[model samples]
Target chain A: MIKVKKEFILKYGVPSLAVIIVAIQLCLVHFQDLSRWKGGGFGMYTEIHYFYNQIHVSGMSVDSLIKDDPSMRSTLGYLMLMPNDKNIKKAAELVLKTTHKDSVYLQIWKPIVNSENGLYKKVLANEIHLKKSEL
Target chain B: MNYWSAIEIKLKDQIALASQLLLFMLGSYVFILAEEHKLWKILVLFFGLIAWLFFRNKTKHPIIWIVFFVLLTIDLFYSYFWVANHHFMLVFMVLSVILFSYHKQSDILLKNIQLLLVIVLLASVMQKITSKQFMSGDFYYHAINLGGLFKFFFTIFPESLEIAKSNSESLTTLKELNPNLTEHIVLKDVFPNLSFVSRVFAWLTVIFEFLVAVAILWKPKKIGTHIIFIILLFGILFTRLETGFVSLLAISGLYLCKNIKLKLLYVLIILGCITLIITKFGYH
Candidate 1:
């Protein structure tokens, strides 16, 4: 071997290095655990919830709210009372982070604007949390 | 002309190169492809619902949203709260329902979809960036409401369901099984009401997303970023908890992973993986 070293290894001698590199990735993925690799910090599951929950916590259900209809679901009150699940909290948190005070404004309008009845001006109607002053 | 042209070309190349470097370093498109079918369903139902809304006036036209919305709600609860899988089945269901319903109003459906998708993606990014979080703070509450991943685990691996139609021996196994096992617990359940975990998770998600965006916008140097990208894009792939793998591929194709060649390849690979994901996980 010393008398006739292979030209293949001489020209493409990175086999050992390649093996080391691949082994490193495999070992790291398996053991080193760098970059939080698969951990949940900004993981896939977290983002999935972000979008899925968007429909529920938004001012009204898409079917009813997009067209400004109030009959199908509550604008704010009942939905607010609806169990705030982990998904809702995530959607709300996204809304809060993205909109800041705008979230509060829109969140308030959820009930006010949702009433099918002319309850926006009414003192006591289906949705009770609204005050004229707030409006 | 010679020197200036060369310099201009080099500058353009460098800007493209810099963008590539930025996107490459970022973990672009985390959950974008992991729960593809489910994401597709979410995308489909999202658009179908819009289409359904466009024809909501038809009254005669029917949308069995009860089933779809139930799935959507379930997925939302799981992804945000519990662990979600098989979201792609929902995707197919939505697509199949709306496949041939193309009509005059379909253009309106398309326009609304285009506009809303932009808003959703931007809102998603904005939530990630401004708050120094990956997603949003509301995530924890959503997770709790859905009972987090544990609920899904129970749904899939129920003690009662495991027994055969009439296996008396199954009853003994049920008694031996401890429903109170914390090993099956998700992080949300572990830290039940802790708001900070969501906040922390949100911030981390944003940072990772920004990194991914950087990778998406990257320009290919010699070998290009695909090799690096596969390694990097997986910031979302390995977790595989929320969205289907295809959603991640689609998002990466549309935005974050800008190198077209790599993006296309990523989409194809994830699409191929769809069936495997579906049968193994069951649709959320």
Candidate 2:
């Protein structure tokens, strides 16, 4: 049994040690995060989601489709509970038509409200004007 | 309509990303240079190279696998799960299982792979179990999504309802993505066949992982089997695992391989590596 064990170690043990060393080398290539390596993480889609969700909160009806679809109950959790914001109501109406019409992201009409358009960028950036009473 | 806004590139960060890529490239290349200068001086280098190549065989494309793994480990240790990382983790867990079956080794590569998967799974489970408070409050709270049957329990509990109902928004793919996505939408996705797909994969994964122990034990009597298994591992690396291709290149250097065979595999792998660099660094 001793001899057999020795033979096993001699044959496979050496090779195994080598693989581990290489793995360590490969593991060192990451710049701290797995997603960072793949061009993920900091994409504009995140901003878009944030932008639309805010619009939905400001009295936009685009989220109504989500509530209608029970499957979306979990995903649209925050959108369903909060009543739409008042000041952004007109902007929300324009945003909702486009969001609900084609993509369902609640910001389809965003093209009409270009980044050059003052309110569009503000909504996209998540900055809302505070009313005196609310303040 | 302007979904294209999803890509927010920071041109200034290129300096940092480029520096990192260069560091790993040069670091990994030193071993190859040494191997060229002397035949058997780098025994450890030899073995590491072979393991990397065998794992990256299928894609016939070379990649910066070592970089991928290193980055992945950093993310795990640093606690950044983001949705993409979640996908990458799932990919890694699957690849580890496949490689665990190839070649006989005394080192704990196979065992370590298994251990890593277990650690990740346990971490995911714990994250969910402890977030019962958050789950009760946030409707889109993943304390339920990929969390599986736990959603049912949370749904009926009045305490959970009041808290969970506090928020009324659907869960987005990018929301709270770092640790695990499966925990939240498990209940809402309610697709009939999707659960079946997930279940099949889960069971198969476990079985394949345990099979590594057996594969190692049987390797001595199955020399030919070892070659085939090693190649299969390479396929899993290149195809299923992103950084695995570079690893295959590193490990392949460890063993004395046939020139012709190495050349063939190298061609396929080179294309992949080039693509990765171009996509990642804008190199032609």
Candidate 3:
């Protein structure tokens, strides 16, 4: 008779199962591109706050940004607000990239981007204190 | 021992001493998760609490499993992907504890907790390594920049927001060419030397995360291991408050400690964690 030690199950079986489950879930989410799926556009508070900040910092009026690429006005707010949710951030980035490709607007407002494997996510705010010497 | 004999041996420790503590921890977690709900979640926690107090170590009771199963069912219905992943594992482990009737499988139960700690820590290491921004340090850089700790400092001084706003403006202009820039831009005046320091902190976090994962697998018997756990726990406590669930895993490490003195110390650490959790939650 084959003897199965309790230690074997605890040490290997359960943990392995957990890892496998997470891996599968992550894969499904990424391949489905669920992060980029359009949701209800940003609420008013998000719109006004981000637009004002952009205008203040870059000297690019919100009117110009909207006129050049209307999609950007809807997506920029999410880049600033939803930094932690990787999928939502990715979706927001996808919208911005599509709308402002090769434009100076793209240069002036870049969301912090992080990629793992094939998945990419963006965050607001970049490192401001690093010197050329450090890089 | 044969398979059957192993099962028989596992049944010997009929009472799991920490079952009450586990119930309290998991119950409180569920209550917090479902705090905004009407009555279903609250009633479940209330019943679970009553059962826990009345039957602390009576792990063999069928009613206990039923209550837990009901909780699990409700949790599944409400489980969204955004709910931190650890909470799912907590629910699973809690159910397993109830089902195994730690009264009958105390040793196995302890092993379950240990396995949980190892898996969580190891997966975290993998996530960091796989994340390109984490390796390049940009992820950490921005995370810290936008994190609660950074905002908390500004909250107290309020005067510093001007410097922060000015620094942020300049930083945005520097990234016009590349949205995914990993390198940092030097601040003009206030905290002039901090960008590199932030980068170093970022790398340190990854290293610390990797080390803690290894410590759990190494069994954390030595004082050095305990210190690593402490540094990581308190470090997150201040930097990234959201990951505070790790405190429970540290408490779970007590199961692996060889000596009574160390176990007592682990208990005290758990108390400290509970107090911190209360403070954060209450304030929120």
Task: Return the top candidate by TM-score.
Answer: 3
* Models sorted by TM-score, best on top: 3, 1, 2
lDDT of each: 0.35, 0.33, 0.49
Tens-digit lDDT string for candidate 3 (B196-239): 65557656766787787687667656667767776776675566
lDDT per residue as tens, model 3, A31-88: 5322211111101111112221221122234445556664564454444333234423
Instruction: Please give the distance, in angstroms, between residue B115's alpha carbon in candidate 1 and its true position after superposition.
Output: 15
Which has the better TM-score: candidate 1, or candidate 3? 3
TM-scores, all candidates, are 0.30, 0.27, 0.60
State each model's TM-score restricted to chain B.
Answer: 0.33, 0.30, 0.69
**Candidate 3 deviant stretches above 4 angstroms:** A2-7, A10-13, A28-30, A33-110, A113-135, B1-19, B36-59, B62-73, B99-103, B150-162, B165-190, B242-244, B281-284
Model 2 share of native interface contacts: 0.01
TM-score of chain B of 3: 0.69
- Could you tell me how far off, in angstroms, the CA of residue A9 lies in candidate 2 after the best superposition? 11
Docking class of 2: incorrect
DockQ score for model 1 = 0.02
Interface Cα RMSD in Å, per prediction:
20.4, 14.8, 12.1
Mind giving the per-residue lDDT tens digits that candidate 1 earns over B25-94? 1112212333634755576557766776777767644354333544454444444223222232233223
TM-score of chain A of 1: 0.23
Q: Report the CAPRI category for model 3.
A: incorrect
